[model samples]
Target: MKIHIIGGGNLGSAIAVGLAKNAKGNNITVTRRNIGFIQHLTEYGIVVSQSNTEGISEADLIILAVKPHQVDAVMAEILPHITNKIIASVLSGITLEYLNKKVDGTNTVLRLMPNIAAQFGASATCISARTADLPKANVVTELFNKIGTAVIIDEKLMDAGTVLGACGTAFALRYIRASMQAGIEIGFDAKTALAIAAQTALGATEMLLNQQVHPEQLIDKVTTPQGCTIAGLNEMEHQGFSSSLIKGIKVSLQNIKSE
Candidate 1:
């Protein structure tokens, strides 16, 4: 499979790396106005990082990974060479209709929102393709499945998905930092506290997958009535962890909508 990717930024590079590592005979070209990511794409082919001005070769898919503001310009740049191929866009705020208007012979349009875990092939991505593009949607699903979990969502809901999974990394990290701080305050060294806290978080996440237990149920197991864990839980609850997280996600979602 051959893919031409525009905007070789973090998310773009991440998806490319994921595909190149897992797929056989995969040819990927990360194209953008600049070559900031050219050095990284060299192992695959030097041609991709070069200017895509001459037009890209026939590709199974063409990806637009440029910033939201650059969407129009990038689409215009690729307009002449554009083919009737699948175009998967990972840019935020740019809708399908805008893209359809910008490029011709390109009915196969898809919008994706994937988090940063993609670098480790562990991202959570949501995809939505047009009706004409539905036939080829699974190909994208399968490709992203190599990187992380992929779910099909309505395009209307993609902005929310961005706030949910795309920005969720920092939310998880905040908990990790809190846990590490708690460990340190109790007497563990910085490194030991961080290791234990991070591993514990990892273990808790794995438990959610491996054991299929609800978070509250897991908390139940950890906190015996009148125990130290319960005391900590009570204090955290008093401090409004649930309220804070809910408000944070709500505010973030609103911010995405506003943007």
Candidate 2:
């Protein structure tokens, strides 16, 4: 696949690196206003372009990784060159209807929500597109799956998925940071604390994935009657840990909706 990612910002660069690492005979091009910032990507045999039109002209898939506010200008720049190529956007809050309208319905559009973890090939990406574009959408799903898990969902749920899967990455990291802080308070070195916290989180996630069990089921197994785990869990609840996370997610969704 010849993939052109417009906007070599954090997300765009991460996706480029991830795809390059996978090396599936894909020719990847990434663009940025300041090309110097992403020039290193060329070391991985990824092309770096400063021209959106030039990049889009030679690609089979055009990924819009630009900011939501930049979409209009970007679409204008590439609209004349766009053909039947698959257009997948990683821009949050940009609806399919908006994209279609901007391009004058010249392309098949798919909205993707993937986090920073894609750089490490562990992103949980969500995808959505019009029903008529399912075949192209599946191609995108497969492309993202190379970096991590990708699920097709209803377009209406894309914003919710962005909060839970995209912003959720930061939420998970914050919890890991908290665990490390607690470890430090209890006498572990910073490095050891970080490793323990990260590995424990990874193990918990793997268990859920492998067992296909509910999180509460695993919580039950860890929380013995009158145990320290139960005590800590209860304390976290008392401190509104879960409530804070839920509220945070809701706020993120509202922000997207308002945008």
Candidate 3:
């Protein structure tokens, strides 16, 4: 695959680096006006450029990772070269309908939400395309799977997926930070506390993924009648831990929809 990624911002650069690590033998180019920020991508044999049209002309897949407001200008510059290419957008709230209308419905358009974890080959990318475009979308799904897991979803649920899959990374990190703080208070130094908290969270996630069990089932395994685990869990519940996280997710979705 000849992939051209525009914008070269955090998300774009992450995707480029991730693909470079996992999708060997595929030519990838990432463009940013200020090329210094992404110059390091060359270390992985990725061609870094400051020209969108140059990249788009040579790519089989063109990923638009620019800010939502920049789409019009970008389309004006590269639309002519994009015919029949797979056009994937990582811009939040930019729907396939908008993209289709922009490209005059000639290209295979896909909307994808992938977080920064893509740089580490662990992002959970959610993709959506029109029913007729599913076959092409699957090609994109397979491409992204090289960096992380990718799932096809209904366009209507894209906002919800953004909240849960993209913003959710921060929410999970916040939980880890809080856990680390608590660990510190319980006597471990800051560095040791963070390592333990982060590893514990990773282990718990691995268990859920590996066992394919409900989270409550694992909770049951950890909590005895009056164990410290249960005591802490109950205290957190009493203080609205789960409810707050749910509310935060809901608010994030609401914000995305409002935009």
Candidate 2 global Cα RMSD: 1.5
Winner of 2 and 3 under TM-score: 3
Extract clashing residue pairs from model 1.
121-147
* Residue 111, model 1: Cα distance from true site in angstroms: 0.1
22-56, model 2: which lDDT tens digit per residue? 74689999998999999999998999988988867
154-205: candidate 1 lDDT, tens digit per residue: 8899888998898888999999999999899999999999999999998998
Worst 10 residues of 1 by lDDT: 44-53
Q: Rate the local accuracy (lDDT) of all candidates.
A: 0.81, 0.91, 0.92
Model 1 ranges off by over 4 Å: 43-48, 53-55
- Tell me the RMSD of model 1 versus the true structure: 2.1
- How does each model score on TM-score? 0.91, 0.94, 0.97
In model 3, which runs have C-alpha deviations exceeding 4 angstroms? none
Among all candidates shown, the one with the greatest TM-score: 3
**lDDT minimum window of 10 residues, candidate 2:** 99-108
Candidate 2 clash pair list: none
| Best model per lDDT | 3
